[model samples]
Target: MRRNHLIALATLGSAALLLGAWGFQYLGYAPCKMCLWQRWPHGAAVLFGVAAMAAPVAILTLAGALAAATTGAIGVYHTGVERGWWEGPSSCSSGDITGMSTDDLFNQIMAAPLVRCDEVAWQLLGLSMASWNALISFALVAIWLAAYRKSAP
Candidate 1:
């Protein structure tokens, strides 16, 4: 794997992630907080890929790999949150509401996000988007690592 190859792979992965999100949105599937959380690192990976393409540098490829890995880790955490293996953030998931006025409750309900990070809106072959992202992003990370290894002096 060369720098250009790694860069291309990273870019393609970012494009795929973006397109997948857009497709889900287009189909009326809104992203939860965790889903939104998973996208930033992919965006960074894409940018790093672009930089690598522009300069064909080993550092940029490694950066892209790091970004991919970050997103993949987040995706794994998200999958756990969805599967009830762990708890998600209070901003995305339900939490204890022992003390709250009716107005506060109403406001919370009204301001609450449409999507719940703890629930899977879609899945295929028992894999949700987060799982898919983990698999794909991890593969991208491997390509990047291989590129780095092969380019080592």
Candidate 2:
């Protein structure tokens, strides 16, 4: 495909993923902090895609690639958090509460978010949504790179 088409495809791919994430949210999957963080880069990429189409600047394509990579990295981090490979944000992750007073513990429980970043609410074939995002976003990165290379003089 031509550079513009490739850029459009990559942008559309991000839009589709974002829509899917929102769909899942609408279906009652409340996104945690990390999940929400993963969406921003996709949004930026979509904007970058528009700029790329309007101007076809190499820099915009590069920015799109970076945006994709940012989301992909966040996805990987979220996957690790979900799998307990590492800790997530304290506000979103369930941590030890043993030292807290009874009232404090109760308050913490009551104030806790409905969604926990450390838990996988949905998955397919042992891969969580974050994992899928990472995989797909990386593919989009490749598309962005291809567009960039194609536009290179």
Candidate 3:
């Protein structure tokens, strides 16, 4: 495919993912801290995609590729946390509070976010949303890379 088509596809990929995240939010599926963290890169990629549409520059494609890869990595990390393979941040996941006082524990509980990063609130075909995001973002990464190569003169 031509460079412009590739760039548009990559940009649309990020936009679609962003829209999907918002759609879930609108449906009352609130995202956790980690989930929200994964969004920034996609948002950036969408912006990069728009810029690439105008300039179709190699730098823009490279930047978009980086953004896609960033979100993809976050999605993988989030998936691991959700699967209990590793612990997530204390702000969004339950952590060891063995030495905390009773009041401290209570305060922590009270201050806990409505959405926990470790919980799989929704899934499809045994894959959580994070898993799907990672997979799609990987594809987007490939598309962006192709665009980058094509944009090269």
Candidate 4:
């Protein structure tokens, strides 16, 4: 395939993922802090894909791959957090309230993030959205890399 077509396909993959996220949000599935974090790289990848299409630069293609990898990593981390493999950031992870003073507890509650990252809001066939994102983003990374390789001499 031509470099432009490859770039377009990679770009469309990110665009489709973004649209799916929005569709889930519209369906009342609120994204947690980590969920939101995973999205930024996909957004960057989509932009990079566009730029790569325009310039056909190897650097831009690699940048898109990097962005895809970033999101994939984040999604993996989120999956770990959701599965209790490790504690997520304090902002998004639930904590022990047992030893806290009443005031401290109240303050923690007030300052807690609107959505907890450790919980899976939705799942399919036992895989959460984050899991799906990781799988798809990794695929995007491969496609971006293929485009880069094909673009090279």
Best by TM-score: 3
Which parts of model 3 have CA positions greater than 4 angstroms off? none
lDDT of 3 by residue, 80-115 (tens): 999999999998998889899999999999999989
The order by descending lDDT is 2, 3, 4, 1
Candidate 2, run of 10 with poorest lDDT: 89-98
TM-score of each: 0.89, 0.94, 0.97, 0.94
Q: What alpha-carbon RMSD in Å does predicted model 2 have with respect to the real structure? A: 1.2
- Candidate topping lDDT: 2
- Candidate 2 C-alpha lDDT tens digits along 72-150: 9999999999999998887899977878999998888888888899999999999999999999999999999999999
- lDDT score, candidate 4: 0.91
By TM-score, the better pick of 1 and 3 is 3
lDDT of 4 by residue, 12-77 (tens): 998899899989999999899888998899899989988887786799999999999999999999
lDDT of 3: 0.95
User: For each candidate, C-alpha RMSD in Å?
Assistant: 1.8, 1.2, 0.9, 1.2
Q: Each prediction's Cα lDDT score?
A: 0.85, 0.96, 0.95, 0.91
- What is the alpha-carbon lDDT of model 2 when measured against the actual structure? 0.96
lDDT of 3 at 116: 97
Candidate 1 is scored at a TM of 0.89
* Model 1 lDDT tens row, 66-151: 99999899999999989989888877876557798899888887877878888999999999999999999899898888877766
Give the TM-score ranking, best first.
Answer: 3, 4, 2, 1
Q: List the residue pairs that clash in candidate 3.
A: none
